[model samples]
Target: MSLARPRALVFDWDNTLVDSWGTIHAALNTMFARMGHEPWTLDETQLKVRKSLRDAFPAMFGDRWEEARDLYLQAFEALHIERLSPLPDAEVLVQAIVARGHYLALVSNKTGRLLRDEVAALGWGHYFAKVIGAGDAVRDKPDRAPVDLALDGSGIAAGPAVWFVGDTGIDMACALNAGCVPILVHGPEGGLLRDEEFADATPARHFRDCMALAREISQ
Candidate 1:
């Protein structure tokens, strides 16, 4: 597969750009405990909870999805920023791309306001043209709805030229459903859970971190 030089590049937040797993794990553990469910380990939570909240909340919370949503948000709001940090090389990559003038957006399962706040906090808000998150559409990643909302009226037509980069299988599925190219961003040692790996994710190129991804694209 030929990796298109993008007219606009979109990214997934969380593991792809930042290391907020501690915050997430803590909040989720608390949320789950409050509901009398066994708290999931960080790995387990990442594996089972990558779907957009809209898609996963009902199944996880049943009739209490709304209540659970509030609980999760409250938990997250309490600690996410305190534990937030950019991935080792994300900024250099984002900056290099901005320098090249390609439009950039973020498609993440995170809440919209929180995601925006995180971006601004990192001083990286200036790089993204738009950031589409969990509530940005009726549905989320792997559903095509959020992707549609992301592209709608942006004047950027859909298809392969649009690359969706994230650290997991959910991101790959999102790209596939959206009919865009799927790019996996993994550590150089690359260990991710099963079932999220795509049969066709050739990766066009692999990078150790965002800086590496950007350096390659720059070359």
Candidate 2:
């Protein structure tokens, strides 16, 4: 794909840099069962988990959303680190970018403390200048507030010089909303936003995985 080096890169954590779907799916099901709600299949989890818990839980759990949120956090906190899985070549890409001296930040829908813990667990915390997550900003992804927080003090304005990379439509929408270049990081094995779906977002590029993206940007 045609490209230029970005001044800064902001990434979506789950499924973009790491494979957390299994852990996330299991944790969600655990919460659901405890709440006497039907558990979501893994496929359902992938389809539905695109927003921060604050943004999505109210609609999913109604008046009891706070209780469900607490339960989900308890379950997820217990299992996330043990179940955390890095996507292939993700670490290499992170290293490559750092080596080239590009600023890096993470903007995730995951709870703030939980997201930082996962990054530290992988020993990749040093690579990012900031790690903005749910509740870390006034608003979250697809709203531009988190993106603003992520790039703050990095000296890079949010525009073409910045790239927001992720695997989902929500991520793309966030990038577009923030006026950053949207780059889709697609995993060959998953069912996710297709090319047609991304057309509306006007993504700057699409790579099959981290390796493909690293090669292009690291050049």
Candidate 3:
């Protein structure tokens, strides 16, 4: 299926643009240890860690979820900037998209403060017109609220002319919910098994990585 050229693009932060699994895995384990739960293996972390803390913590940590949230945030804040790095060619992709004159924004499940900090740390604050993160919207990814917030003031309504790009099913679902085109960008980790991993949210197209997506977009 041919994708309509998007006038506006919304990106997910973590695995989509930056390689943050190491920091995220460590922080999650730190929280789990303090909460008296077993630590997840890196593989388990990759497989299961989705959803914002505000959305997922209560289910995992029960009445102590807020405490666990604090622990996780503390660990994440301490480690994130030091460990933060963009995925290969992700900057190239962003630049290419900007050169195409497409409106750009970010919608992430990461805490708003931390997400903004990472963008500034990477000197990428200028790329996105709006950077909506968890708690910035009434609901997180897979919900249309953040997407709507991200596009606010951009003069672009959510529709097929908007491309929501990310590395996870959550992002695809968010795009679908917002009536936008869902474009999946596989990071260095490679593509997901669509039938198994993306059963709930299918992408309109998948690229091997940011470079590949950039190449396609440039065409």
lDDT of 3: 0.92
For lDDT, candidate 2 versus 3, the one ahead is 3
* Runs of candidate 1 exceeding 4 Å displacement: 187-196, 200-205
In angstroms, the error of model 1 at 39 is: 1.2
Q: lDDT tens digits, residues 142-185, model 1? A: 77777777777778866777877888777777888887877777
Clashing pairs in 2: none
Model 3, residue 110: distance off in Å is 0.4
Candidates in order have lDDT scores of 0.78, 0.89, 0.92
- Name the top lDDT candidate: 3
Error of 3 at 145 (Å): 0.2
TM-score, structure 3 vs. true: 0.96
Give the worst 10-residue stretch by lDDT in candidate 2.
187-196
What is candidate 2's lDDT per residue for 1-219, written digit by digit as tens?
566679999999999998899999988999999999998888888887889999999998899999999999999999999888899999999988898899999999999999999999989889999999899999988899999999899889898899999988889999999999999888334433444545567567778989998997678
Q: Clash pairs of candidate 1?
A: none
lDDT, model 3, position 139: 94
The per-candidate count of clashes, in order, stands at 0, 0, 0
Ranking by lDDT: 3, 2, 1
